[model samples]
Target: MRSFVTFASAFLVGLISFTNCTKRTSSTATQTGGGMAAEQQLAGDDLTKARANYTNFCGGCHGRSLETFVNRKWQHGDSPEALFKGIKHGYPDQGMPSYDTTFTDQEIRHLVSYIREGIVAQKGKTETKSNAAVLKSEKLNFQLDTVLTGINVPWAMAFLPNGDMLVTERSGTLYRFTKAKQLQKIEGVPEVLAQGQGGLLDVKLHPDFSKNNIIFLSYSAVKRDGGQTLSTTAIMRAKLEGNSLTNQKQIFEAQPYARTRHHYGSRIEFGRDGYLYFSMGDRGGTKVNPQNLSVHAGKTHRIKEDGSIPADNPFVNRQDAMPSIYTFGNRNAQGMALNPTTGDIWLHEHGPKGGDEVNIVKKGANYGWADVTHGIDYNGSKISDLNQKDGITDPIKIWVPSIAPSGMAFVTGDRYSGWKGSLLVGSLSFKFLSRLELDGNKVVREERLLQDIGRVRDVRLSPDGYVYIAVENPGIIYRLVPVSN
Candidate 1:
């Protein structure tokens, strides 16, 4: 939606000449061999130009890959003539401006061909019709081995020192998948307010879990205030016994609980420096909480392993600020990971309509959520006038049109050939796993793997060096086993 001004400027450039050309009726451009001829005419430089044109003009709303329009119900027809007329005549009432005088008919034809080609490519990339058991990517061939099935809304997962797995469902049930492939429900999970986006969320183990037997769970903790139920992101630390959780203690809770059930960011991770790092969403208090550090929402926090605040936290010296705050102005960060190579914490947060972001957590940094954003509101309104400003840390990567990123992990070791040091991010909206090849902190290339796999809830590199993915909507867990080509 940040591209609205760009689109408006492009439209206004040819607005004065719009009345010069007569509008074409459907019969004027009949479906015939002419369409095919025009499409075939586009190749090489012309095709490249069309792709650039689309990225400039249409990628803001329609997405760069053009996957936003794929499989969705087209209000108007999607035929070549329909697209041609729609582009030339415009649908002003529907927010689609006509580009009648802006582009020549031949250029419009080239655009049509480019769009149709993108549709075909996206379809082919998503649909897996041949050999469902095995999946192939650009660099590696892999197959999915089903790990667990029939779990509902598996939100987060943790691997134990003994090779057992712990998975938390949004419905507040925790299950343990043993090494023998047996599933058993763990007891003593705290009650959660499983409403909207609030529920049981991330699970993490202590760095010395083998000796401490300590694990942490982040969830929406509910409390009644003034006869109304309110919830906030809370972390519970407990000892994991054979099949139960004991010595349960509430370690940290975001202050000023809200009535809104969504945006309880609850991703938990431990840094290499013997400290626990976690995230908190704005809790629908976008305007107030993110910029105001006195409250806990919309922040990355650091604490000692036993829930005590570290003396060296960024805001520890500020009398008015929360002592545990690491970074502030995050919207709703559901994905947090520790970069194995750099020892830096990486986080990804959801944007409103567009402008999903990936940022490296820095001490006392402001990410500029409500104050500055590349995104617009869900109802097509601008959130901020500026996308960047002084003192606000810009994201390392920004995904326009939003991927709804969740569960991030850095691939370490050479378990998968040619994929070492890649960052795997889950796409909840596109239902895919994104493999980002990084050059230091920058994402140089992105490859989409497991396209249309499911609503990917979590992705993690296990202790054994295999990449595991958790997906919802007929929830299932899968291990990505590399296969030799």
Candidate 2:
């Protein structure tokens, strides 16, 4: 399983729940207090009530046994509050709910206790719930009482004018979420090619969405290859009419034989420069295209949002090289960000075995993976001792014990005043959100949050002052809300 399980529980005792994901920033040891929040005055049953409320309201989507280690985080792991803030202010466009007004603080408390105790229970198989306040980070904190559950696996979501949202499930289903906290499935949607990792992958609106009503999607489309075993990733542009994708046009298709159910590394971000940056994952095997200097696989490419490469692309002079190649030599890079202050591309990719990395993506630079890596050979075998040595570029930061880095986002909201200039990497392995402070192109320090918030797959900052995250299967989209001023 290509997952990032970076935390070592056997050696870590009583560590609080935290978000853990690897990102490109220099590594510096954290010296903040390792402690839980103060035990505030509360009803003895607060924990129980919170637990029951979550079970009753959340189980509808996250699975009946939602506490069964979605990311398998063990003892001394991250905690549940990470999910709390998210549940209170869900990514309405993703079909999730908010209990901000539906439940009281006492009820939220019970839920946090239940989740914390549940993590401990997994280690012993038999343990009674305790009454201690769960631990949290001093610099970064999570809301424990709220939980993000019951949202279907949405392919993409777009916020509405009033801060509500419209989300499309990968299975070709669309839903509407209102600010009043109601989730209703929209009636029509284009049929998605839902096979593997290729379905309705990403959904974005034109910068003038309010006026043009334009939307775009990245999905795999079935393409006949001899018999019945092929499809390819394609980018389509369409306009939203009510709840359906209408007049969708195929703007881009990976060259022929782009038929893989997996490794459809598709993510499109509109740069402040008015260009679009797209990522394509390595199609399965250790080798394919990007590194070949002849294909676009496993690379971050730049193109006009209209799908044309700029003439000045680094490799435009070469016939075999794909003009979209911004940086090459990547494998399954899922997280991407453009720093709010500097506008540099921040990218994170899954590392084999170990050595997950966060890198300040530079144009035309080669990021060595199979060719150059800090990782051991899969199957625990030894490989070249190529870490910070080879001519291959080095990662700004790496997890010796892989954290299976997934999604990424910059901290721009006021809720995270201390983390204003930092980046958050969502970890599928460590099951928490990892924080990094940057000094221009370098990372300076690191910290972890939500010791138990397992397998954070996606981190997104809403236009509003909220941080939303997605945890894979029994998957859910959650929100980080600020406390009242």
Candidate 3:
């Protein structure tokens, strides 16, 4: 596991320091006298058990002090029964699994009771019965929790059929969350570069997860500098076992890495045709870096499942020109998603300073980044009118000030019937999830969710119908629950 720095003070900041955890709009928990004073008991074997449980099951991801989101008001002051249901049901899709079977009712109650006591104390309240059925806190308008806290910066999540979730932290940590949400840091993931924006980044499960149990990971791998003086970018594939990764293989790697410290576009998805679609950044430089077909940077790549280039690729059977290049002319497009409905890839990339773009990814096409953009250069020089012409693909939507959109997922579940067809786009610079109403290929309506939450990095739909958002700050994942229409 890469040593991602963690501080216990992050816990105090995440929870109590914030006034509340309810979605800025509405909430479900209630803050009132309906529940008795909050108090908790932890002694002898009980204390030992809770500590052991947290250590063995959760310590790896949540940190020694459970700092991540433990400080949030919503995490504390929940009634035991409410806590039980939340833990028992497991927010699998959100990366919080239920641990009801592994832990007894008493243990859960005590654990939850302990959490409530901390909050009650924070609120300066007295002690009473261990209320189990009352409101967990104030009614929650949205769903938010500190799913797991201690792991290295968790980058992405993939759900299993049993409502379990496997998450990858940026610093090469792989962890498993039970359905009840007890996080266990899994061992045996291959060693990652863990340096300068180059650790494990994204993980997506095979569509037929139940049958294959196969998973894919994208990261920057270190390689010899060749005759020159730099490294390279490489993506690896692996099969995940209980606590380890097996058959690790490097499927793709870039030639001659940049001396700079950033920009390695690594997002992977299986297309409708069964070809693997992936991308690579331009290795951080200005002027036609990735757009050049002769080079490997700044390209949307396509390949076979086993790391072989497809014969029918855009440049099929070509020599120097990369046959894997599906498209070019991009800046750092960190997020890519296949329209679960249209079989088309929707791409969001960070454009020049302010012109962040959302584009319908095209095959064998170029998206004008340095050549034409609605944004200004770092020192401020306007590029283009965001026109649609010539050989460049126009973006479907562009943010003027730039929200720095990271990851996006189309809402397809019934949990929030109103948002069923909307796109949940998590914006890191904006610290919110932008909901875009989709009318076929057109985006019609837009709303920003979780304005109060920290930097939202990614969003996805849970199999159970809810949406999960990954926030980077203290690094937490929150679930959005709709209490009202």
Worst 10 residues of 3 by lDDT: 1-10
User: Which candidate achieves the best lDDT against the true structure?
Assistant: 1
lDDT agreement with native, every candidate: 0.76, 0.58, 0.60
Model 1, which residues run further than 4 Å from truth? 1-132
The alpha-carbon lDDT assigned to residue 425 of candidate 1 equals: 91
Please provide TM-scores, in order, for all candidate models, with all chains considered together: 0.75, 0.69, 0.69
Candidate 2 lDDT tens digits, 1-485: 12122211121101111222222222222321212232343346665565444343443222223433444433223444444444444332122334444443434444555555555555433111122334345565445323234553444456766577766555556666777777777543445556444566766667778898876676666666677556555677777777566776776776644544555656667777777776666655444554676776677777776788887678878888877778887766767788989887778876655667887677787787566766653223343456654455677887755666766889896876767878888865456788888887788888887654645656777777567776654456666654323
Superposition error at 306 for model 1 (Å): 1.6
Extract clashing residue pairs from model 1. Answer: 90-98
**Clashes (N, CA, C under 3 Å) per candidate:** 1, 43, 31
- Model 1: residue 310 alpha-carbon error in angstroms: 0.7
Each prediction's RMSD over C-alphas, in Å, is 10.5, 14.8, 16.6
Measured by TM-score, the strongest candidate is 1
